[model samples]
Target: MSLSLVLAALVAVTDSATHNGRAGQTTVPAVRADTTIDVDGRLDEPVWRRAALLTGFSLYQPADGRPAPDSTEVLVWYSPTAMHFGVRAYEPHGPVQATLADRDRVSADDNVEIQLDTFDEGRRAFVFIVNPLGVQADGTKSEAGGFIPGSNVMPGQNDLSADFRWQSKGRVTEWGYEVEIRIPFASLRYPVGAPQRWGLQIVRHVQHSGYEETWTPARRASASFIAQAGKLVGLAGMRHGQVVELNPELTNTAAGAAAAPSGDWRYRNDAQLGGNVRWAVGSDVVLNGTVKPDFSQVEADATQIATDQRFALFYPERRPFFVEGSDQFNVPNTLVYTRRIVRPEAAAKLTGKIGRSDVAVLSAVDDRATTSDASRPLVNIVRLRRDFGRQNTAGILYSGRTSGARATTTSPAPTRAWCSAASTSRRCRRCRA
Candidate 1:
């Protein structure tokens, strides 16, 4: 099939699923900033005064889709470097459940959240949330099959592990609470273009009353509520300057081992240096490479299973290189698991968009998951996906493995053999699990 035709089919499927929800999306124009935003949780500047307000909230909790009793006002403005928001959440009766929590630990507190589908893809979004005390929690959301989340308690659309640094501040006032948030363009990923139309949603969570409301009513029955969210119109002059990242890390450790239980153990030193580089090839593609990458866990996992299992358990990806954009891969049976690549000496990954299609490729060599030098192998994965209708994707995947488990092995030797296969797969993730 022609490339254009394939993309068209992808879009058709996605649009169909997303369109099943409400229609006549709310639209708001983001004004260009004329003055500075102080970010003190106060909207006293002229920038906010000139911004447009988006209101008309409806209840999503305590009722699937009922009218909200309290009032809310959302003002939006943007500059070349960042987007700004001024949110006023009015609560008349109850005391705000503000907490002095650490950064990225403020969601459970009485908070307000802004979900931006910067690419306007609906299935994916960058979520910025801040509590009344200004503590913040951010994450990424992926909606497959454009599924509307089943319940508020376990809203299945967000990957809270996907966090980024952004600016936010909030204050509890006499009537309610207000928030000011600034998200840098560099911290987000969006197609570079002007006159941009992005999907957006504003939500307020009241802890005292267990109230949930959205500026644009997010219906329960609709599978793709966020995908079918209100639109942010008139976005212009958006530029995510040259994307380049350089990260370097160093670690030193000492370990001791004894031949016998009572033998005096001798200590050995282990020191290593590692780093990675990320460079964007225009706005559509990103290239990442790492040398001697260290995939050590900073915090130990506390969750354990005592039962005998028929298959290996699943744990979320955490390594920086593998976690980013990891969701777009749709290889059948999840053939690509980063944790399996026990000790990847080096690795490279490329991800971007071509026309309406999503593409990702990864190549690495691990010397960890096998027996000895003879069986070491290389791993390569490629995924191409197209979304045509509401919240579904049709994609193709190719995986090549030289041998053994993902990476565990005895010696640090290079891989030689490789087996390859290609297959087609369909997946719908309407919300995060």
Candidate 2:
């Protein structure tokens, strides 16, 4: 027989063996006992099927003690204009309490969160998190920081809506729920390309039963989806339009001055104008920068008590200059050097991929104040890093500072150094003697 015929027959046999637990059952034509099946062809068949089977793909789940109904099956589909999601949660028990309260009223019991990460495969992506009660947790159009506190719906801030529906059958044993989400293409941003993979997670809260089952496995219950997410494949031919953003901010600050013995009130105000620019540099890399970035619009840090008696309280730098992915430039085991580096008022960043390696670099002039003091002299830092795949990297770092004259009629002295290294290990070894 022809090779194509032989391959097709073998596929039938392999599919039957792999999918034995599924409902379907089939047999393949018997072959010679000594025959060795082509292993490459067998592996290629399933991969192609996985890439092609865009609709009706169910998220894989391992055997665990989580209460998963035998009839529970999730169905997912996508279109050009919007992504369509449907879930057929077969609750074998009687009809349970499914309420639609304000998003802020979410609790551990009987709640569901639908999270979407547009750029699932890359470092930067937009995350949209919504609960069953139409409450949104983090609705930012970009990746969130690790230290930012979780956000609940604000009072009188309820303009967003989620198009959802459901139905019940018999008792809690045979109930069903369905949700149809129409995420506008304009409202979302994702890297355009063929075979786009996305990180996704779903959490179901059974309030009455006090149970929570996550679609993606996670080590911590409250961890963000970044650390724990499953892949959504077969996203070829997806495209994103120009990213347009409009952010207008206003600020008013007042302070009162009081003498030690007598108390008196004095008022002062400072106003500033600021905004950010986001433009796609080609398709994969996104260029982001801010002019006079303002942190007054951002929320205050969440309250926390310091239990440790030895160390000072931890306060992350809230400056906008540090928020633009600058922390990644920090050199490991060199915290003092990093802290002394002058923060730049103007910066130009280049990030994305050049061939197989991921490249990121930041070039900026250090602020004047940080470099002025001799004790904690501020120095300009130019951090460059290129990942050579899986633990391999090449980096070049330069820092310098000019100190003011110690006495009259003298010029400032300059201090500078260049550090370069290449490493296959986790830490970069200084190559310069």
Candidate 3:
């Protein structure tokens, strides 16, 4: 078996307010809706009329901090189980950019995007995109400072595979176009409570002019702007039904080996089966288990490497098995790489919070090919974290690899672990007298 194993237990403690930026002062009040939203893209609904509006867009890409030449207005509202946003883009002069593409592939035309840090941590976000034609695109982003992904997406730069289950509707009017987006809370992760304040960033992409003006200024020279995004106040007292999902699949493969120098060969065909189960432990934690799991990646890995690079290149994880709850495993350096466990036969991962501590654990076995010179191995990872005092966190991370009867470990420093995006992040150790 060839495999990679990364396990982390993270305890995130931050003010949530001051960790990213001080000028992120934008705020929106919550609106309770008793009326149904038709989502026909015509902003004539009664719910939209009562929702608080957000305006005054500023540029961040193609040009930064410049006032948008065109007007864009956004409004937000929510029910107990879902969240909503309405967009009214005015273009009185001629035609507006619109495309008729399949779902989750709306980058060619002028679009409006929303980014939300549901956890309110300065680390990650769930991004959604919609074109004037009402086509949609959605995915997750890694924003743990220093490195960023898909900054200001254009035609070729966007990764359409980043998908999340959501809905949108839009229609062109004589004035311009109107859009409405509906996102379920089940599709998002949040701490259970009343009146929660989450981080938010609203972006308007002007195609012809190539403008990526956001609700708040996101400078290229600084950390991830989503972490520095504005505030969305009043998300409280919501309920999420228990979620259970089971995936079962089968595979067929044929291979042969030469029996003699005369070209005689022995060939055989094989059929394999497997399944996976996920049970959400309430709205806060998730438990997942698999039996001979087969995650045949439908899309190819996007590793467009050059022939002249000086060091070995590590590709990012695109397989679904490794993508779930990946945030808890982040470190500053390359200690545990998921791609190392390229083909996992069986694995289990658990993610959730216990009091003030956050934890994640992953265990996997690999009998597939990883390196040209080495055989596959068993992988195990553990991460535990607790947050206290300002935005600082202290945690421990350890990863081990075992093949046959031999094994080795990667340990953190006495005071702090080696914090690398390839590894993990900041921590302050406790003193023992």
What lDDT score goes with residue 129 in model 1? Answer: 86
Per-residue lDDT, model 3, residue 428, is 31
Question: Candidate 3: where are CA atoms >4 Å away?
Answer: 1-25, 34-36, 62-66, 93-95, 102-105, 146-162, 217-224, 254-269, 302-310, 353-357, 368-376, 388-391, 405-433
Q: Which residue runs of candidate 2 sit more than 4 Å off their true CA positions?
A: 1-67, 70-73, 88-128, 138-177, 183-192, 197-203, 214-231, 250-270, 303-312, 316-356, 361-433
Computed on alpha carbons, the lDDT of every model, listed in order, comes to 0.74, 0.41, 0.70
Candidate 1 lDDT over residue span 1-433, tens digit each: 9999999998875443231112333776567764456789898886676676776678898786666777777788898778898888888878888989986677668888889987788777888888986788877776643211111112346666556767888888998988888888777777767788889888888888888888776877886767657887788776677788898978789998885777988889999898899887665688899877866753444475858677565555667787676766634344566666667778999988776689999998776445454566788989888978756678888888776544555677884432232123323243211
Residue 5 of model 1: what lDDT? Answer: 100
Superposed Cα deviation of residue 165, candidate 1 (Å): 2.4
Candidates by TM-score, descending order: 1, 3, 2
Report the error of model 1 at residue 433, Å.
63
Off by over 4 Å in 1: 1-25, 145-156, 255-268, 330-335, 369-375, 389-392, 404-433
Predict model 3's lDDT versus the native. Answer: 0.70
Q: Give me the candidate number with maximum TM-score.
A: 1
Kindly list the per-residue Cα lDDT of model 3 for residues 1-433, writing each as its tens digit: 2232222211121122111222344766566674566677777866776676777677788777666666778888888778888888877644788978777766678889888877676556778899986799887665432211212222113334345667898887777788989888777777777678888888888777776778776776664566557878887766677888899878888899988778888889898888888877766687887767676655565656667688656566656666667666655454556777767778899987665566889998886465443555778999787766534567888898777434435568566334344234333344211
